[model samples]
Target: MQTQRSFAKQTTGTLYLVPTPIGNLDDMTFRSIKVLQQVDLIAAEDTRNTQRLLKHFQITTRQISFHEHNTQARLPQLIATLNAGQSLAQVSDAGMPSISDPGKELVIAAIKHGIPVVPLPGANAGLTALIASGLAPQPFYFYGFLPRKTQQQVAALAPLKNRTETLIFYEAPHRLLKTLASLSLAFGEDRQIVLARELTKKYESFLRGTLAEAKAWFDQHQPRGEFVLLIAGNPYPQTRADAYQHLNLHDYVAQLVTEGHPAKTAIKMVAKQRQVAKQEVYRAYHQF
Candidate 1:
C-alpha cells in the first residue's frame, strides 16, 4: 500500500517512465521531451536508437543501456543512482517502457527503495489500433507478443478464447502468418480481427476481417511491418457443461492434454468442471 505523489518533493530522486513515439516522430509529447532533457540520466533500451531520438529533439542528456539482456546487471547501478538523489528517466526503443520492453524491473527496484516512479503517458500502439479496430474498446486485454512456438502459442491462447473483452497482441511481420493461423485454430476462423501495420507511420494501414480472411489476405500480400492485432471477444461464451457435454470425463481430460495442458493438470481441470473428486477424475483418466 504505497502511494506516489509524483510531484512531491522528496530526498530521493524520482524515476520517470517516459514513453517515446511508436512510429511517427511527431507523436512524441512535449512533456516527454522536457523530461528527457531535464533528467540527470536516461536509461535506454537501445542507446543507439535513443540517440537518434535525442538528436531529433536536441536533447543532450547522457544515456546508459538498460535492455532485457542487461537488466539484471544494470538494476543495482540504476537503483544506486536513484538513491544518490540523481533523477533518472527510462525509455524503450519505442512506445511506453515495460509494456513489452525493458523498464519493469528498474521500476520495481525503485519502488522497493521508496523512489518515486512518475510515468508520462504518450503513444501506445495497442490503444491506437484498438480505437480504430471497430471493436468494443473499454474492455480490452493486451497480450503482447505470443509465444513463437506453435504448441506453446496455442496453449497460451486457449484460455483467452472465451474472453468477452477485446484482445490485443503485437507480432512481427515474419511470424504474422503463423500467428494468424494459430489465432484461427484457438478462437475460430470467423472471429473478427483487425491487423494494424506500421502504426502511426506513413505506411500505417488496417485490415479488418474475419481471422480466415486476414490470413488469406496476408498469404497474397507479404506482411510488411510490426503489427498490432485486435481480436473481437467471444460473442457466445460456452458454459462448462455446454463446452464438454459430448465427451466423457476421460475423453474431456484427454482433449485438454491435446491442447497442451499436462495430463495431471488436465485431470484436475476436468475434475473441477465435473464437480467431482480429483481422485475420481484421475482414476477414470488412467483406467482408459
Candidate 2:
C-alpha cells in the first residue's frame, strides 16, 4: 500500500480531480476555476461540454476528450504527461469527477505511476440530494447506477434490499419509471423513497413518498431531468421471523395470504422480504 501526501513536494506533476457544477453555475468553486486555469492540460469527459463551462468561467485551458470509449487510448498519453512534470486536471460534464463519472481509471493510473492525485472538493449530486432527502444521512450506501438489463438489475438490487443504510442511486429520466418498478419489486411498495429531480437547477424538485406513491406519480406526470433516488433502509429487524424460519416458500406465502393479503400480493411480498425474484415465489406458491 502506498501513502500519498497530496501537498508534498514531488518530482512528477500532480493529477487534480476537479469537480464541475452539477447544474448551477454558481456552485463552481473558486479553487476549481483556478485549477482549470493553472493546469497544463485538462482531461475532460466531453471536450464540447467542458468548453461551454470553460467559456463561462473564462478559463482558456486546452482540453482533450477522455471518456469511457477512449479511456484506454488516452491513459498512456495522460500518464506520460504527468510523468513529464506537466500538471493535469480531470473534470466530468457535471458534479465530481470519478463518482459515476469518467475519472476513476485515470486516478488509478496516476496512483500506480506514483503521480500525486489531488481532489478538489466541490458539488456532488448524491450527497447534495441526501442532505435534504429526509432519510437517514449517515451510514449511507451510494450505489450510483444499477445495471440496465432487467435480470442483471434485479440481481444487483436483491442484496441491497436488506441494507439498513439509506440507498442512493442515479437514474435518467427515461429509465426512471422502470427503475421505480424494479425498486418496488425488490424493496416492497411500502418502502420510503425520495426522488430528487434536476438538482441545483431552477426546476429542481423533490418527490418524497413510498415506492408505490412514486410509481403512481410518474405514471401520470412525465419524468423530467436527471434523478437522484434515495430509498429508506429496511425498518424491520434484519433477522428472519421465527415463524418464517420453519416455513417453506409455498407455505410462507400461504401464511401471509391467510393473514390478510391477496394471493398475488402475498407472493410479491414474500419475494421482496426473502430477496428472491417474484417469479420464483409465484412458482413456489403455485407448485409450478
Alpha carbon lDDT at 136, candidate 2? 97
Model 2 C-alpha lDDT per residue in residues 191-239, reported as the tens digit of each score? 9999999999999999999999999999999999999999998877355
lDDT of each: 0.93, 0.92
TM-score of 1: 0.90
lDDT of 1 by residue, 1-288 (tens): 888888898999999999999989999999999999999999999999999999999999999999999889999999999999999999999999999999889988999999999999999999999999899997999999999999999989988988899999999999999999999999999999999999999999999999999989988999999999999999899875677779998889888887788999998888887899999998889993
Extract clashing residue pairs from model 2.
none
TM-score of each: 0.90, 0.83
